[model samples]
Target: MTYLKSAYKNAGIHHKMILLIIVLMLVNFAVFAVILKYIFHIYDNQMYKKTSEVLNISSIGIENELRNIEKTTFKVTTDEQLQRYLLQLESETSPYTKMVLRKKITNRLIAFAGSETYVYSMVVIDKEGQVMSAGNREGIPQELHSTLSELADEYDGSNAWYAAGHSSLVAARQFKSFTDSNFTLNGLGTLAIRVRIDRIVADRVQTSGRDGQLTITDGKRMIYPETPLLSESDMQAELARKQPYGIATYSGGTFFAAQVKSSYTGWTYLHMTSFDDMFRHITIIKEIVSTIFVIMLLIALALGTRLSGSITKPIVQLIQNMRKIEKGDLDRLEEEALGPVPFSTQDEVGLLHRTYKKMIRRIRELINENVAKQLLLRETELKALQAQINPHFLYNTLESVNWLAKANKQDRISEMVEALAFLLRSAVSFEEQLIPLRKELDIVRSYVTIQKTRFDERLIFQLDVPEELMDAQIPKLTLQPLVENAIHYALEPQIEPCRISIVARVREGSLFLRVEDDGPGIAEGFLEKLHSGQVTTRGQGIGLANIQERLHLIFGAPWGMELHSESGTGTSIHVCIPYVKGDQGHVQGAVG
Candidate 1:
């Protein structure tokens, strides 16, 4: 099975199409053959039924005729003249009187036989084998007289019909004295009626001029029309199979035969006909159908070759062009190789060819654009390298200003410049995003020093962070933003003294830090504006929103800042972050 599948897969479209057509044709032929066989079976059953019907009709007619013969036999045997004459013939020994009695009995037999057209002869035999006859010149065979008498005696006064010869039927009965009712069954002599059975069958049975022949069996022997297709014993064996009415092959399997047994006579009637003759037309039809199928198959093969060739030709050309492209000949794709037509149409093959051409053009354009972009990127990198010394220049300039303030005996100016330089360095540096809380506090203290010089003594700054949490890791410059917002929003707006406090501790495995201010608290909705980044910071630093974003970015969720501020009261901002020791081991489920 695997080999067949592999072979089919490797076969070209043309051969595969031919094979497919042939397979389909064979399958159709099989279905047609089955249907034809079923039709033949139906026709066969119809034939059997029709033959059985005809046989049944003929049997009925023959039975009626035999019944008439039986009635005639009964009338003759019970006749007072015939019965009395036969009894007297048994006792009388005078030749003249005996001859007279024989003549009278013969006349009576002739009278009885003349009433039926098919009765050939009628004869009576006494116990001593004296024969009296009528209706035919040839009488009963002398050799058959005793046999006929014995058969008649076995009937015991009832009519017993049997086939006499190839062409005749004999009904034999024993006659008794009708004068005494008690002696009615007593046997006196045998009376036999020889009937022309051929004449009776000829008038009664019709085969409609078909080749069908009839065979009658008396359960033991063939009875009529001497040339039987089967012997008596063979026919009896066939009948003994006991299918009363059905069709089957018989007569050495030469003919299809239907048989029906008569209920009245117990004889089986068969109608046999040659099988070839019976199914000749059906055979011819089958032959014609088979021939047509084969012719159609040949025509389909011729058509399939042309069809597969048309479909596969374009596909093969496209594959050839793709192979050229695979070999790096991007410009070698010819319009003719794409499809039969240079321009596209609505069909899928046409669409595929057009799309391939478009893709090739796009590839060339992108190659040129990518080269130009690469040149521009190299030039920009050189300029960026030239500008790398700017940060050091700014730091050196601030250090020079700080020393000049100290030399001028300007203490406040020197302190502010030193703090500004430190803040500048911390903001500009990008070495590590996470720093120890103690380092972040140093940066915050530097920012507060600069703000405190600006606010004088009105800014009351307090630091309440614990010593143990100083080693905890937090994002660099995180606390400076919140503390600056408090000074700008809480203290800078009022002339009176306002206090700002930075409180830090560990709670539920997280560092919770709050920057509280006691100035005129943030105005209504200003805290919202501040958190949404709508309110710009007055100081040169990242706002509270930026710090919240930075904390969230580093520690994921539940680790941002929350603001609590009300009008005429202090504003407090809570900053929550995951607790990590200075070595950077993280605490899980810590942020709240």
Candidate 2:
């Protein structure tokens, strides 16, 4: 096993692929051969079975017609008028009465003959040798009388068919008086119904071979196929053997034959065929298929070298390049290391090389980019540290100014400076804690005092907040931004003083703070953008939207801000928050 493996490993890829193709071809042909043989046998068996079935069906149909003929003969004999006329014509010597009786019998024969398409001729021969006939009068010859009378001789009130000359199917039935008490042989007559055998088997034959023959035989003579495929002696020999049905010999092996017995008539149906002629196209098809297989195999061999080299050479180069990298020889990538070569076809190997080249280029770009990203990261860290120092410095300066104002005894300046210091302190600690509403109001008042110093009498504000909500806690700076906005947009740009009302109301276990300004109302477009948070205003330190988001973040999302304004009227901003005071979650649920 080791030696075989070594030899296979040493073999060229071209030889390996050719070997694989040869193995596949052999397996495919082996399976096709078995299926082909099976299909051939099935074709022959089905053809013979189909031929026998068709012939059997035709024979039954012909027997049914003959039975109808016999039944019609019995019906004619029972017609009392026709029977009386026949008997009267035989004995009456009056010429006028004889003419009338003959016309009546002829009319009766016409009725039976016209009833069925199978009836070629209907003839009735009385015991007195008088004859009456209807339908296809030209069909019966003068010699048909003697020939058909012999068939009627042995009949015991049933039908007997004969292979009459001129391809006639003759059924003879003996008619006797059903009502006469003295019914004897002399009183009986023959009713002969002649039909064309060619018409009986007209559309019945189904055979693939053009010269194939299907015939009905009465164990005495062939009854169909006016031109028989077998000679008279050969047909006689085949019939005499009485092989109920199945394979019979024909001209050498070129012809095939099978027989089936009719259930309606005790007749044998024979089918003869030339199988070689029928299956000659199959041989031609086999030859064509063999030619195509050989041609494809030759083409495969011709293209084997190029196809195998195209697949294996690129993969082998990629593997060698990988091995060099694995051994840490990546720095020695030079002319000695194989480069990618263009393929003559778009195959998997070509795709692999294309991807490998792209990967090598992308990896080099990524390494260079990663180094630049690390340097930018250090620069960003320095900027972040510088950003932290400025806020601390501003807070320190505010404290120093507050202390200096107090020591100098500038009472009003000291008050303003201390409020500034307290607001700055709250702002610094705002993110870390929640404050009481009173602390928020102090910040708003201090900010309002500072704003009033700039716009003396133009901003008149009132606080109508209830004492119950004064202790309720909320996010710091929630209401201050809204009040600052009312002072800025509503009072800052007006000559007349505008009144600002701050009211706190509790309803449905929730606290609602309303800030109203009776100044020129917000513009229609700006109000829409403000409500939708599409515009921002820095009236105080943050816009109304910022306080809204803060209230939502501190409480749940359901607590937020609401705004209502008219064009010429005033504006109102409502702050809706969960009512939480010192130790209470909500007003009614307050624990303290």
Candidate 3:
């Protein structure tokens, strides 16, 4: 009975709590609905309309280019030079005379077709299946004879037509001979021009406006300016459908995409504008709304707290206890009991108080369970580390000696051995402490020198270290791991010679060390995973992960690794550590 009363009193619910929650929820819902309808919906609709306009413009441009090619083919076929070539071939009978005629015709056709920018290739074939003239014989397909025969019948052996293929657009025209004085027409030969479709699409795609695509298709096959967004089968399936459809989806927090079919070509053109690019204003609005919501929430909490205190004393005490629990205190409730009340209450305040007690108990149990598990995990990790030191220590010692012997520098070798000894001593003696930037760079240089001997001519190293930043404090062995990572991941895979650059500079009292490589860059999606501290299937190479962990532990969130890369370019790892000069140590790089 005392427990029930105590729980009721400490629940911290009042009439004002009910009223405030109801009002805020209603306000939030109404605002969200109104904004969604007026702002987001209308904006998306406008985007769809704009996308359709762009598709229409692109369709018109493509149609115009196709028409231009057809017009050019018509003009070339009717030219006086082409007629003369055909007449010369028809009049000849001897093999030498025919060969001479064929050469003349070939030269004339080449001169006429080569003058145009878009004409990929031209070929002239006689009615007797003899090749008379040709420019770029590679363009002439094996199936040309059949195609020309059909074309010859359609246009009375003088008409022009376009053929669509996998990688080329063929424009063929048949020429005739006027031999007799009666002006009778005789089939002479065919002229065919092939144009690269990819190049043509590329040129048109470039001129298309934002989010616009130029699509070329003839009933079955389609060519899109953009690479296939949908699978080939999916595209074909979508194209097969007769009715026009449009849909908008939120992809990566931005709305982008509109598809339209060309009535003439039966090709669908899809225009995609990044929502992030288009509706920046919405993000701004969301930020403003979020800021306003936070401000209002704070104000509401303050008012609710003050108002509820007067009406409910026991409830206020319960809230204070809950705050203690929030601060990780799960001992016991400090407040006393209030009067008896049923668990089922019509009032909102009573319901809230009942729910609060149940939640507090559950949270306390979870914390206790989590703490025990964490302690066990930490113990297991410590045991694992203790078991794996001898092998690592021996390996590092051997590597130091090898580096010394290869360099042939006794003095530097002695210094490096001493440094390695000191590092080992520090590791065994002192747990871990921040060290000078000079010490870190020394370790990094030694590591690089060791790797350099292995790679020899294939690896080149450059360093740009400012004198002023040498003494800046940093986590021990901080720079070494990053440099090692640059070598292992960036340079090791390359067959060609690679360059590794290390730059250390001071920026506004903060020391920055950048390790860079001119090898195949880090794989795409690596940066996001590294930044988020997400465990990936491909392990973060050796020292890279260790360096990041140490930075985070010593300098919190801001002073850690920043990675940048592009495929085929290379990768860069930037380490930011706070600078401290003389006795005046600034606590600017405190860990979170």
Tell me, by lDDT, which candidate is best. 1
Candidate 3 C-alpha lDDT tens digits along 1-592: 9996776566546754856665785688578758766887787677667666766676666656766777776776676767776676677678898787778877887887777666677777776677654556356666676676568657875444454555556767667555354245666677777755556565655434454334455545544433544445655554665544354443223335555666654555655455565667877877787777778767776778676764476456556666776675545532322233356664665766666766755666887899998999999999878867874776587577857765786765555565555444434443447666677666666565555557878888888887776776777666665666667777778878888888888777677788898878876686666556563222223345666777777777677778888888998888887766534464453321
Question: For each predicted model, how many residue pairs clash, with residues at least 3 apart or on different chains?
Answer: 0, 0, 0
> For candidate 1, lDDT tens digit of each residue in 1-592?
9999999999987788889999998999899899989988898788778878888898888889999989998999989888788878877999899999999999999898878887888989987788988886445677778888998888788888777566557889999876663355567789988877777888998973466678887866567767777766667666776665544555466666778878878887887776778778988998999899989999988888787776677667778877777787745444433435556355776777777778877777887788898888888898767756787888899889988998999999998888989988888788987888898888988888998887889988899988988998888877788788888888877899988888998867778888899878887677778879887666665777787788778887667889888888989988888788876554433332
Off by over 4 Å in 1: 1-64, 84-106, 125-146, 153-156, 165-167, 175-189, 196-214, 225-234, 242-251, 254-384, 400-415, 538-541, 584-592
Q: What TM-score do all the candidates reach, one by one?
A: 0.70, 0.44, 0.43
Candidate 2 lDDT trough over 10 residues, lowest sum: 583-592
Report lDDT (CA) for all predictions: 0.80, 0.73, 0.64
Question: 215, model 1: CA deviation in Å?
Answer: 3.9
Q: Name the best candidate (by TM-score).
A: 1
What TM-score does candidate 2 get on C-alpha atoms? 0.44
For model 1 the local lDDT of residue 380 reads: 87
Of 1 and 2, which scores higher on TM-score? 1
lDDT of 2 at 8: 82
Per-residue error for 474 in candidate 3, Å, reads: 99
Identify the runs in model 3 with alpha carbons over 4 angstroms from their true place: 1-19, 22-26, 132-138, 143-145, 148-164, 176-186, 206-213, 223-227, 240-245, 248-303, 314-592
Residue-level lDDT for 4 in candidate 1 = 95
Give the winner by lDDT: 2 or 3.
2
